[model samples]
Target: MLKKLTQSETLAEQAYREIKQAIIEGRFSPGEHLPEEAIASMLGISRTPLKKAIEKLSYEGLVDLRSGKIARVAEYTPNDIENFLQLRVLLEPFNVEQIVRIPISEEKMSELVELVEEQKKAIEDNDLYQFIQLDAEFHLSLAKLNPNQKLQQFIEQLNNNLHRRYLILSKTLEYGSKTAYEEHVSILKALQKGNPEEAGRAMKTHIQNVENRIRGYQASSLH
Candidate 1:
C-alpha cells in the first residue's frame, strides 16, 4: 500500500520523495503513464502537491511531461545512457583534478575511508539501495572537493539524473555492486596517495566501465 505523508512544512517535497522512490523501485515502470489522480488519492494528498512533485521529477529526468499528454516515467535509451556517461567522464575527472590541487584534511580522509568500508558491507549484505546511495555519496564527496559551487551543483544534477539508471542497471547486471565497490576502492587509494592524475584516470576508467556494462546490457536485451 502507498504510504500517506505526515503533515509537514514541505508537503510537496515529501510527495516528491515518495513518488521518486516508487519510480526507482520499479513500482512504476518506464513509459507508463503516472495516474496523477490515483497517486494523489493513494498518498492522501491533493493534486496540487502531486503536480508539484511531478514537476520536480520531470526536472530530474525521471518523469516525462508533454502537451496534451499525461506524465509518464521517463524511458532511457542506450544512446541516452551513453550520452550521460560521456558527460560524467568529462566532468568528473576534472573534479578529481581539482581535488589533487587542494589539500584534503585528515578528518575528511577518514570520513571517506569509513564510507568505503560501509559500502563494502552493503555489498556483502546485497543491499542494493544502500549500496547505490553510498556510491553516489562517494563520488559527490569527491566532487565537493572543488571550490566552485557551480561545478558542485552541476555534478549533483547529473548524479540525480543517473540515480534511477543506476538502480535499474544494478538489478539487471550481476557484477554491478561488486565491480563498483572495487573501482571505488581504486579511486580512493589513488586519492589517498595524493596522485591527482592517477585518481583522475581511475575515475575515468570507472565511468567507462559502467558505460560499457550498460551498453552491453542493452544489446543483450535486444537479442
Candidate 2:
C-alpha cells in the first residue's frame, strides 16, 4: 500500500509538470477550458491524478479552477503584464545579488554557458520556442544558485508569466530576441567575473531593458 501510494504521488507530480509546461508553451491558450477527460486521454493518465495536478497548477496561479467550471489557463491583461514586470524588477536583482554572494561552481557556470550557446543556435534557426525556453532556464538557473528554496520557487513562478509574455512579444517584435540575447551575454559575463555587485547591476539593467521593450511595444500597438 505504501509503495502504491508513493507511485501515485509521483505520477501526480509528473502530470502537474507536463500540464504546466504545456500551458507555459501555449499549448493551452489563455482562458481555454481544460477538460479533464481530454487532458487525461492526451497524457494517458486517470482523471484522479490529473485533477490533483490541475489543483496544484491553480495554486501556482497558472490555472483557474472555479467551483462549477472547468479549469482554464489564467489570462493576463496589459495591466497584469505591467504589474508583473514591476515585481520582477524588484525581485530579480535581489536574486542576482544573493546568488553571486555565494561561490558558483565551475560546472554550474559552464552549464549556463551551454544554455546561452543553445539559445544562440535557436535564434539562428528562428526557433522562437526553444529560445524562450532556454532564456527562462538561463535566468532561473542563476536564481537557483542562491540556495534559498523559497526565493527560487518565487522566481520560477514569476518566470512562468514572463515566459508567456516573451512568446507573445517575440511573435510581434522583430528585434526583441536579439536584444535579449545581448543582455543575457552581459549578465553572464558579470557572473563569470564573480563580482556580486556587477552581477546585480547587470541583472537590473537587463530587466529594465525588458521593461522598456514592453513599454515600447505597448506604445506602438496603441497607434
Candidate 3:
C-alpha cells in the first residue's frame, strides 16, 4: 500500500513526507542529527532522494541543512515559540481588527463560519491533526480578508511556524484544543457583530492564552 502511494510521487517527495512526519511526531527529536546514509538506509531510498527531502524540510524551517554539515531536525524551544507568538500578538490582532472594522463580506464570513464548524467536529472526533489544520485555516482565512498582500503573506508565515511548532509539542502537550476552538468562536462572534474593539480584544486574549498554556505546561514539567 505504501509502495503504491509512492508510485504516484517521486522518491524525493515520498522521502520528504516521511521525514517531515517523523519530525512532527517527535520521532526525530529537535536538534537530532540526520545522517544521510542512515536515513537513506532506513527509508530504503538512495542518498540523492534523502538529500532532496532534507533540503525541502530545511526550506520549511523544520530541518537545518548547511553545506558540508549533517542535517538536523530544527530545534524550537519555548523561547522560540514565544518569539513567534510575540510577533503574532502584534500582527494577527491588528489584522482581525482591520477585518472587523471593514466588516467582512458575507462570502468571507460564511467561509469562517464553516471553518469553525469543521474545527468543532474535528475536536468532537478527537482528531488532533485535523483540528490543528483547521486552526491554521481559520486564522489564515481571517487574515486573507485584508487587502494588503504583504500583510497576508507575513501573517501566513507566522501562522505556519506556530502550527509546525504546535505539532512538535503535540505529544507532550494535551493543551486543550477545545479551548482554542472556543476562543476562535469568540473572535468570530465579534467579527459577526462588526465590533472591532471586541474582535481585537478577543484576538489578543486568544494569542495570550496560547502563551499561557505553553508556559503552564513548562512550569508543571519542571516540578
Candidate 4:
C-alpha cells in the first residue's frame, strides 16, 4: 500500500499527511522538535520524503523550520490564537453567506447534524481528540458546501493553524463540546429555514464562543 501510494503521491505527500496527523492528534506536542531521520524511520520511508513533508507543513504554518535545524510544531501565543480566531470571524461568515445561496442537499445537511451528534458522544465518552476533530469538520463542511475552490483552500489553511490550539483548549474546558453542539444546532436550524442571515449570525457567534472559551482556558492555565 505504501509503495503504491508512493507511485501516485510523492513520498513527501505521504510523509506530510502522517506528520500533520501526528500534530493534529497531539502526538507531536506543540513546540516539539521534528527530527527528519526519526520520522522517516518510524514511517518506514526515506529522509527525502520526510524532508519534503516538513517543508510543506512549514509552508502551511503548522510547523516551524529553523535554518539548518530540525522542524518543530509551531507555538501558539495568545496573540496567535486571537489572530486565528479573528480570521475565522472575518472569512468564514462570508463563506457561509455564499453557501446559503446554493441548494444544499438534505443528506449533506444530515451529515453535519450527525457530526455534531458524534461530538456529543465523544464528549460523553471523554474522548477529547475525536471531539476536536469532528468539531473542525462540522465548521469546514459548512464552508465547503459551496463550490468555491479559493474559499476551501483558505479555510483549510486557517483550520490547520488553529486546530492544535483548539485541542489544547478543549482539554481545559468541560463545556466546550456541549456548547458547540448547541451552536451547531442553531446553525443547522437556520440552514433548514433557508435563512442566510440567521445562519451567518449563528456561525459568527459559534466561532466567537470558541474564542471566548479559549480565552477562559488561557486564563485558568495561567494560575
Candidate 5:
C-alpha cells in the first residue's frame, strides 16, 4: 500500500522513492502510463514534484520519458534483457575471479553469509520486494569487492536494467526466489573455498539459469 508523502528532503525525492518502489514491486507495471495528475493527487502533491521524480527515474533507466508525451514505465524487450544478461555472464564471473585473488577476509565472508541468510528468510516470508532487493545486494556486494570501478559501474547498470524484469517474472515463476537463493549459496561456497575457477563457474551458471528461466517463461506463454 502506498503511503501519503511526509515532509522530507524534498517532495520530489520522496515521491521518487515512493513511485520507484511501486514500479519495482509491480504495482506500476511496465509500459503503463503514469497519469501525472492522478499520481500527484495520490501522493498529495502537485505535478511539479511528480515530474521531477519521473525525470530522475528516467535517468536511472527505470522509466521512459519523452519531451511532450506522457511518461511510461520502461519496457525491456527479450533482446534487451538477453544483452544485459550476456554481459553479466562475462563481467560477474570475472568479478568473482578477482574476488578469489583477494582472498576475502573472514569478516567479509561472514557478511556475505549473513546476506544470503537474509535472502532465505525473505523467501520463507514470501517478501517479494525484500527478496528482489537482496538478490541485487548479493551481486552488487560482490561487484564492489573488486577494485575495478568501471566494472562495478557496468554491473550496476545491467543489474538496474534487469531488476524490474526479475520482479515481474518472479510473480509468474514462483520458484525463482528460492532457486536464486540456492544459486547464491553455491557461488558463496565456491568463494569460501578460495577457488577462482569454481567461483567463476558458479557465477556463470547462476546468471545463465536466470536467462533460461526468463526464456522458458516467454516460450510457455506463447502457447
Candidate 6:
C-alpha cells in the first residue's frame, strides 16, 4: 500500500507548488533573486521547509544557486529554447504515437477539453498569466497519460524551462494568445482522433510559429 503524506510533507508540497506556480507565472522573472527568508515568509512556512521546497525546485532546473549570491530563477537563451523545442518535437510525437494504440479514457479527454476551454476564456479575457498556466497544464497533463513517471518528470522540467520564456515571447507579439488558442484546438482535435502524425505536425507548427514570432520581435527590438 502507498503511504499517505504527513503534515510536514503536505506543508513542503504546498510550498513547492506555490513557489513553482509563482515562478511559472513570471511572478519571479529570470535571474531575479529568490530570497529564502522572503519566500518562507510569503508562504507562511518556516525557512527549513521552504528550503526543502527550493531544493526540489532546483532539482527540477527551475532555480539556480550561485556562490555568495542568492538563488535566482533560471533563464533560457534563444539557443536553449531552440534545443528544448527540438527535443520536445522529437519526444512528444513518439509518445503521442504510442498513445494512438491505446484508448484514452473519457475522463482524461474531458479534462483536457475543459483545459482548452479555460485557455480560450483566458485568451478572450486577455488574462495572459492564466492563459499561460492553463497552456502548460494542458501539455503536462497530456504527457502524464503515458504512465512513465520518469518521462513525465522530464517533460515537466522542459515545460518549466519554456513556460516563462514562452510567456515573454507571447506578450510582445500580435495576437499570440489568440493564435495559441486556435493552435491548441487544432492539436486537441488531432489528439481526439488519435492521429499521431497530424497531432505531431500541429504541435510542431504551433511551436515553430511561436519561435518565429519571438525571433522577429527580438530582432525588431534591436533595430
- Alpha-carbon deviation at 109 in model 1, angstroms: 1.7
Which window of 10 residues has the lowest lDDT sum in candidate 6?
166-175
Q: How many backbone clashes does candidate 1 have?
A: 0
RMSD of each: 2.8, 6.2, 2.9, 4.7, 2.4, 6.3
Model 5 lDDT per residue over 172-218, tens place: 33447788899999999999999999999999999898888887777
Q: TM-score for each prediction?
A: 0.84, 0.70, 0.84, 0.74, 0.88, 0.72
Instruction: Report the C-alpha lDDT of model 2 over 70-123, residue by residue, as the tens digit.
Output: 898876666776677788888888888777768888999999999988988888
| Superposed Cα deviation of residue 193, candidate 2 (Å) | 1.8
**Clash number by candidate, in order:** 0, 0, 0, 0, 0, 0
lDDT of each: 0.80, 0.76, 0.80, 0.75, 0.83, 0.73
Instruction: Name the regions of candidate 5 deviating beyond 4 angstroms.
Output: 8-10, 161-175
- Which tens-of-lDDT digit does each residue in 122-148 have in candidate 6? 877877667867888887887888877
Candidate 3, 1-223: lDDT as tens digits: 1121255789899888778667654578778899988888788888988888888878777888888999898766776777888898999889998988777999989989999999999888877657766887888898889998999999998767655655455332246688888999999999999999899899999989888887776787689
Query: Judged by lDDT relative to the true structure, which candidate is superior, 5 or 6?
Result: 5
Compared to the true structure, candidate 1 yields what TM-score?
Answer: 0.84
Clashing pairs in 3: none
Of 4 and 6, the candidate ahead on lDDT is: 4
| Clashing residue pairs, backbone N/CA/C < 3 A, model 5 | none
